[model samples]
Target: MVTKSDTNSVQVEIVPSRFLMPETAQRLLCEIYKNGGIRRIMIHGPNMPREVPYGPGKGIPIEANRNLLVEIGDQAIELRVKVGRIRLEMESEDYLGGLKAACERALPFSFQFRQGKFFHDRMTTSDYAKYGKVEDERILGLIDPKAKKDKLAILSEDMVTFKEDEER
Candidate 1:
């Protein structure tokens, strides 16, 4: 029974995380390493999914936890950021890569939902209405972290259990 108005009062923030350039897949990092190093960089982290055009999307949404929402997608998940840093090898792959890797190693992020001052995720405040409220169950069966490694799956489960558990 959550209403759009309920969300109007909420704000969400995407906690920023680092990306290990090589961690994604070896293929993408070859050029970066061969060139020695990259100069200057910009990075972006993933955010709560706002409403998109009414076309079918790949997966459902998941709120970070019960009550307050910190939205994240599983299928067709967006990398929270648009830009990022380049790793230079000082000692070992895991070193430069690991520094970023360990920090980046959070793999998927964790969320905390609060009642007041919804996190904005640096989103355009004016377009806030387009972003609808979401629930945690939306993420259950969404991602197969092992198979895709990169993509997460929806947390699919029985609707009755989901709703019932959501309240607790």
Candidate 2:
């Protein structure tokens, strides 16, 4: 049985002073991916309504000014939420320095970087019901079970399997 103390992975949460614009989020994500230690990553923020839910403009499409499209490792991903904070699991704390540097270079304003258990440590019944005995712990709790499809994306499998040279 793997207990929390038995786990070697470290989780990180980054909350920027302000919500990140799509371009800034893209740059930050790209830089973090380049570091190659991230096991899982999730973004959080308020959902931008696709249409005016009520009031005078009910059912009308709304332009929220969110880019919605960003590329990481050359893979384009559509972000459904306005990015305010980022939470990620890393193989270890060895890569935290690189992550900090990446943030410094990408973010023009202040942000908070914290280390803690921000993700679910164990799979729940809902996860098993949705994914069916998932073997990859990294993927657990990363997706919305109610959604038709998972939002998870793999930038490059090779990127996580090995550590890149610490040149940067």
Candidate 3:
């Protein structure tokens, strides 16, 4: 439910030829965020569960191989997807060229970038129920803007560690 500060944002959709590995996605995210002008980034992909859902291994806690620790500027973000499609909300169309170049540099495989609105810009029913009808559109579509804590982890640079024994 991430939104941009500016209403005139263009969504830069980057779809890879194949599902990206965690390392590749991490590298690409770091590169994109470092360039700035990117207001929000939404990654879309198949869900990866933290535990085995069925069979002999049902209910067993397991490491999701696709989960990655990506360093974006000073922020250490945990990517929860295998990274099928990345939708970036940019402040202006002026950053398109630089964004393209950055993507090209980070992604070795084939990918595509397009400019369009990929998400709902207005408030939804669930949003209203969760946070009420707030005047700020930035917090409109979000679930809980006033919450003291966020569900996502914001790790420090030194905490960018991964379990090597985890199955891939």
Please list the C-alpha lDDT of all candidates, in the order they appear.
0.28, 0.74, 0.64
Q: What is the per-residue lDDT of model 1 for residues 1-168, given as tens digits with 9 covering 90 to 100?
A: 853442222221223243333234222233332332222111233333433424586344443311232122221222332223221212222223333333333334432212233222233433233333334423322222232333332223221122112111
Candidate 2: C-alpha RMSD to true structure equals 6.4
List where candidate 2 sits over 4 angstroms from the true fold: 1-4, 65-67, 129-132, 144-168
lDDT tens digits by residue: candidate 3, 1-168: 975554566777889888987778877877787666866556667757677879998988766543467655665556555679887767788888988888898899889888876656677776666656666454332233333223322212233222232211
Per-residue accuracy of model 2 over 7-51 as CA lDDT, tens digit each: 577889999999998899999999988887887777787777668
RMSD, model 1, all Cα superposed?
18.0
Worst 10 residues of 2 by lDDT: 159-168
Clashes of each: 29, 0, 0
Span of 10 residues, lowest total lDDT, candidate 3: 159-168
Candidate 3, residue 120: the lDDT equals 61
Q: Per-residue lDDT for 149 in model 3?
A: 29
Taking all chains together, each candidate's TM-score versus the true structure is 0.18, 0.78, 0.72
For lDDT, the strongest prediction is: 2
List candidate 1 stretches off by more than 4 Å. 1-17, 20-74, 78-116, 120-125, 128-168
